[model samples]
Target: MQALTYLEEYHSFKEAALNSRFLKHKTIQQLIKKLPEAFEQRCIGQSHEGRDINLIQWGNGSIKVFLWSQMHGDEATGTMALFDLFNFLQLPQFQEISSLLAKSCTLYLLPMVNPDGAERFVRRNAQQIDINRDFNHQVSPEARLLKNTRAEINPHFGFNLHDQSTLWSVKKTGKPATLSYLAPAFDEALSVNEVRQNAMLVIAQMYKYLNPLLPQQIGLFDDEYEARAFGDNFQAAGTSTILIEAGGMFGDEEKQEIRKYFFLSILSGLYAISTRNYVEEPLQHYFSIPKNNKEIFHILIKNLLHQDIRVSIGLSYEEEPAEQGYATVKTYTIKDIGDLDHLGAYHIYKEETLQIEGPIDIYQPANFTLKKDNMILLSFKNGILQSKL
Candidate 1:
């Protein structure tokens, strides 16, 4: 609950330097230089592209909480939230919470694990390897650094942070899954040991604190055991691991709004761990949280006459890094066509009298226009939205 109060003034402590979703290693390095002396900063390793991978450590208690973000370089929301957290921990007015954290837990943060991927704004590293999935092979330097660091620290808890697709929606709510939490299964049996259960209990506490602030917007991510992933392996290795994913918000294309909730989740989780309150939370609370599903689209147009048959069309965009990874180019594609009256979308268009100006085909790039009595409702040229009125 205190986290909520702190969230109201999020902009006060939010790292103003890192405002956009496209975060590069250089930007993070600059922010690191500005951090107060309380944080111990050092370069632990380098990416395949020879970019320095740094680690920042704060807090001093026996409880070791290790958090790593942006393993999939393009997933920068977690990295952004982490910077906000770094700023929050140092403010003078928040000594009550900050001192408690410092006295009860030691926080180890690797904000950006794949700087090379972040440089080009791609999912994988420069070696074209998914660092998260390269746990077994340990081929990539970033993966090796992460794995080795965890082993050296042997943390009591782990926070695996990443961003999920915007299309993910809360089951039954049909709203974009703005945030999702998961206690990854350590084994194929999906069994719940004390290790994983602690993670679940912590996640339940997180859900309790976050669900109200983001009502029906947070969902439980899929728990299918990922053999080579960091969360599952960390849980298997006896560290209670929690997976926090930043999904999407309706109007927040850059996820600036979502970042606040994401920061709150992390803060609440840490507070729970610090006070050992997660032990009081019921296991049922974790199961009761709704699961995420693909029940939403980026754009939806209903009652459109395609081939003389009225149908709904769902369109989603594929983001390609542009302007040297400083921006993105969204290419809209026809994702689905048919009865989608039950689905939700960030943008919806339903006019009683409308005309289709070009071909409407599923599984292809969007190249059509919707008009209502000479008024252009929506227009797309070769998958690019030209205008909407």
Candidate 2:
């Protein structure tokens, strides 16, 4: 009955996380074609580029919940997690859990809210609009569709899912925040009303179940009020909206592990809501979770002297997203240079004395070279690193 044990059943998943990275519209359409007829689906709207924004509805219970993922299009972890849920519910072993959920809660899912952005594997749609930020303005068809769906369903619970940068960390823990949660503020004062408190309670339930598995990797996102964000607006409208940000793992560049955590988290939240398990929990637990801090780096270098002054550097990936018709490729580059003690790095390189060869181009790191006593320390070409150490 525990959520952790579900990991044993995940391997049997027909729609596995292993295949979900860089998922394009064609790939998703093919996968959804194989779903059982019981999971009802229909086009809620069309993207600016004419791609279908699909909604999959399930369950017949009194309380209803709505979940949407990849509104940013580049944030696909929760989308993969939903497909896993779709697969798990069909298996015989997990039928009771699914049935129990159905008896108490009805669920609606919008798996890909911005298919045009997903087609380009980018954050914005063809109109260059951010669907999440378009809530107030309804500038894009996707935003309008989400608003329409909310009005039609009137769901009691809303999960606003997204993927965060890989470098986010738990406050002062120096650990990459693997999974973070936020019960967003409905107003500028960031007050905790009943609906917002309910969302926080559910997040505490998730932390209770998953924190033991990840320890310091768990984080609480800042609850600053963003008036135009969908989660805040949804909470303002009385739905218990929870924001889930799937972040980085130490070595899991593809974030397959984080996707599994995403799946577990969703199931746990639904399980809590269906049974009213979070009704008695105090808000103290939610407030106790560490806040997510912005001080993690994928690469770090230390003590490279320039003009007799010591300097350190932090670099990041400048990814080149692939269109639906093209192969996916990501490149890393030197994004910044600083004494970044505030941030933690998964990889660190340090030395007493280092030398820079020729005139260095801060804007063009691809052709730069670092050397020490005739031995090349590192070289960058087209954002690819070559290390001689």
- Candidate 1 lDDT over residue span 1-389, tens digit each: 48678878898889898889898899999998888888998899899989998888998999999999999989999999999999899888888998999999999999999999998899999999999899999999999999999999999999999999999999999799999999999999999999999999999999999988899999999999999998999999989999999999988999999999999999999999999999989999999999999999899999887788999999999999999888999999999999998999999988878788888877999999888898898899999989977
What TM-score would each prediction reach against the true structure? 0.98, 0.90
Instruction: List the lowest-lDDT window of 10 residues for candidate 1.
Output: 1-10
The per-model lDDT (C-alpha) reads 0.92, 0.83
User: Between which residue pairs do clashes occur in model 2?
Assistant: 295-343
Query: What would the TM-score be for candidate 1 when compared with the true structure?
Result: 0.98
* Model 1 lDDT on a 0 to 1 scale: 0.92
Residue range with the least summed lDDT across 10 consecutive positions in model 2: 358-367
Off by over 4 Å in 2: 305-309, 323-339, 351-367, 370-377, 382-389
What's the residue-level lDDT of 157 in candidate 1? 93
